[model samples]
Target: MASPTLTLHQYQTAASETDRTRTTKPTRFLLLGLFGEAGTLLDEVKKKQRDSGSYVGYEANVVEELGDVLWYLAVIASRMKLALSAIARPPEQSISSYATADNEIRFSDLQQQAHLPFAAPTSNFEITLLRLVAAIGALANAQQQSLPEGDEWGPYLREIFHILIQTANEAGVTLENAANENLTKIFDRWPEERHFPPLFDEASDIAEEKLPRHLEVEIYERTVARGPGIEKLYVLQRCSGILIGDRVTDNIMEPDDYRFHDVFHYSYAAVLGWSPVLRALFRLKRKSTPKIDEGEDGARAILIEEGVSTFIFAYAKQLNFFEGQHEGDLSFTLLKRVREFVSGYEPKHCPLWLWEKAILDGYAAFRFLQRHRKGRLILDLNNRSLSIKAI
Candidate 1:
């Protein structure tokens, strides 16, 4: 029938004198890189504590470092070209931010929903780290001339949920469920499980073998270039293991420091002869998480939540929306070429232009990049759904 105004769903183009603000992506990367430095600093501080055996004396610096980490984050957004206008409403106004104050409050409400054990303040280093990271995304929102009288979490929180859900689905796991269950049990909001899922045994094998199929790839590559928002959470959930209460923390303190086994519960099926730790990590739990990262609510919130009124962004290497390949026989070996990029890599080195197009126009978003295709590419089902303009 009629052509659509926009090809897919994602952040709209910027338009305005205020929208002219630059230095957003750089801010985020700055904070991310700074955090890496902070982690190193934390490491050194810990080593000093161990050597001097006087960590209690330096307890205050620990807190100071946390604030420094967040401050760096706040400023990084400034460097990445993030601006108040971007978060409110654009200058020329391409997309309608689509966020509401009601949604902004959810970030705070999630913490109050149920009881969580040993829960730290929303300002805790871990929680604050994510919020600050997510907040840097304030610029991703459509900028506006004026803001309402009272506003809390800011607009960036909405994106965390959006990206969390999608990536969780693609990676094929229930870290979210574990996230929910842990909060429920620890907070006493819900009863505890009588038994723990068995220890995963197949993660290593799957790591070496390959991942499975996903449907959203077509839509994602078509839409975003990973400019901002939930894409942050999506990347986090994929690479690092997420945890909430003691259950989650305890899980991560396993044999070594591997939480993927606990969250995905994949390794449970590795069976002595079947696979390795990496492969087994992908087997235990194949169930997907919700559509967004609601912080403490974890997975149950997803099942109970309603329509998606939030906003998000993503990044992709290519956009071949028209994957005419056999439905069951898609994916490729190159899919494995991006473990670091897809999971845990974050947007440190990813391009916003690519993420924006992937989340909006799908594979077709790679029109400019496609000109460099050395030759037609081949399709192989061994890998997950990936690549653009396959031969």
Candidate 2:
């Protein structure tokens, strides 16, 4: 069966649902974001030009950037009380001769119609992209001079719609595909409502395979002598008064207190309800099912979890361990890279917000342990929170 038809009207309506900006000047905010995303698209192309063959992932990046541009266009048109389906098809005659302002075209009808004249490529990818950006700039300039809910706005809007289609064609991207991907990413990052996903082991009948919903762990440090004149600082973690993981040292020439990094796994468990490393350490592997045991909670999954913890730690270290930063402050690049790290793993099911919470809260706990040298790391999965208390 064919995938259900998607129209510009439907896409515009869906995109509006994800708008988080509540500024009094929404037009300015939307236009500014439009320009910034366009510039980012250009920058990505610039890198492709500078790096040539080494610049892989250009197509994927273009799809994402173009999808963002489409979102802005849709929202801007809606903001101006214009139907995206109507704006999508520029009038063949002068703007004054076009249908009345109240007249709206059904987007479903647009799906039945053949590709518009603008869909034909007028220039190369670079030239077409430049024209599209220039068209947006022209629209923004026009918006400042006159109120958008008037006849003066129609032509500029139509021109932008025209050039945008051509630009996508020149880049060999399907507009519907772009819109679909945009919705997928938007919902993944910011859903209609926030709710904790069910715990990973919620369905397991075996108690040993289930992660503790409430866990209080003790993390402290001690100095031990390996040689006559040398002593090393080590961090140890325990739970329920029993030693859990082995003691760890920084294992680096510099003392960054990385031995306390287990806080990251704790946070992941608490916030995301998924952490293969912890499952392995706590002997909670779901061994009743071979696939769940060897694949989901297995060695490879554990490695991926450890890799994500270390990767995020390296990123946080450069930004003062994300100190004083709140949600949405972490760079999308960092989060996207992390998503890539666990692309095939079970943890990838968690949303970006959960990952952000895990990282920020984990670093907060890590910083606390670093300062006090010992603390209780608390994991409350029911509450979806992690916190530290100094000992």
Candidate 3:
């Protein structure tokens, strides 16, 4: 007797049925199962290599783990409205066809494949599987000298597919989508194929235009003012962490404001290290840009930075004009005026009170500008103008 071949749709249905008793959080549940099973598979491989100095007799265990990984992958595909067959099949016009005469796959070929709007595996699952294939190829090349010649790539391919499928399921991403998004981003960073450099390096001489733009520009016809609920505003030097200037409503101050200001700066910097995909998904824009941080207590913090040198941190009791468009405009205006004031007035000669007064006057000017119903107020510094176009 021989075992019957299972179709892709049938396998997906079976996998979904097996996990029907679990929680409704399919994404989280599938991810945990995929990684947990993969970890077990890797552990078995490691144990065999450590004890026997090779993975000779553990082939059956590896196959079983790979099957387990595939099962989870099928379930995830079902959740994402994708069929396993769709991911398994190669495109009609394959990317490999465009390879150089020597069969060399250049970065340009990868970019061209990514930009093909009609390409198959446009979803995340398909793209991920392709990456797994690449990994398997690399592994085979490295082990060519040690491994047997006959069917040498078979086990390696299976093992990679198992890992790739499970990992993609866990991340709630399809390989195709991830690859396409990444390729687009890479193209943006390196428009020319010849300009693509090594993946990892410490060289900082890359052209500024080659970098991804994180700066956001907001233009408004009218400017508003921070109302009664406005709390504390602090101007801090980013690199030195010095409190350059501050203004408090009612002349009242909270001791925690200093700590909050410091933590906010560090937190913003930390978030910049996150992947572009995660950053875009979560709407985590760059630091120093105007953004609102809301707390559970109905309070909000309006944060803005001036280039990389200074940051304006403001806290408000409510999410009103203080934490909205007005704050963004005012913060930039105040930062420009304050930076100019500090540059000319010798800190050693000027009293601390005078510096504080300068900041207060800037705040006062921002408030006055908000009162104008119709007019343009332009502040030209160093030939750059922050203009209120119209109201």
User: How well does each candidate superpose onto the true structure, as a TM-score?
Assistant: 0.19, 0.83, 0.25
In terms of lDDT, the poorest run of 10 residues in model 3 is 292-301
Which parts of model 1 have CA positions greater than 4 angstroms off? 1-33, 81-391
- What alpha-carbon RMSD in Å does predicted model 2 have with respect to the real structure? 4.2
Which stretches of candidate 2 lie above 4 Å from their native place? 1-10, 24-29, 39-59, 78-83, 93-123, 140-153
Model 3, residue 288: distance off in Å is 89
Superior by lDDT: candidate 1 or candidate 2: 2
Better of 1 and 3 by lDDT: 3
The lDDT, on a scale of 0 to 1, for candidate 1 is 0.27
Compare candidates 1 and 2 on TM-score and give the better one.
2
Better of 2 and 3 by lDDT: 2
Candidate 3: list runs displaced more than 4 Å. 21-23, 53-57, 91-391
Q: What CA RMSD would you report for each candidate?
A: 24.9, 4.2, 23.2
Poorest 10 consecutive residues of model 1 by lDDT?
305-314
Ranking the candidates on lDDT from highest down gives 2, 3, 1
> What are the lDDT figures for the candidates, one per model?
0.27, 0.78, 0.35
- Error (Å) of candidate 3 at residue 387 is 85
**lDDT tens readout by residue for model 3, 136-219:** 445435454564422343344335544464444433333344333333322322232322122111132443312122321111
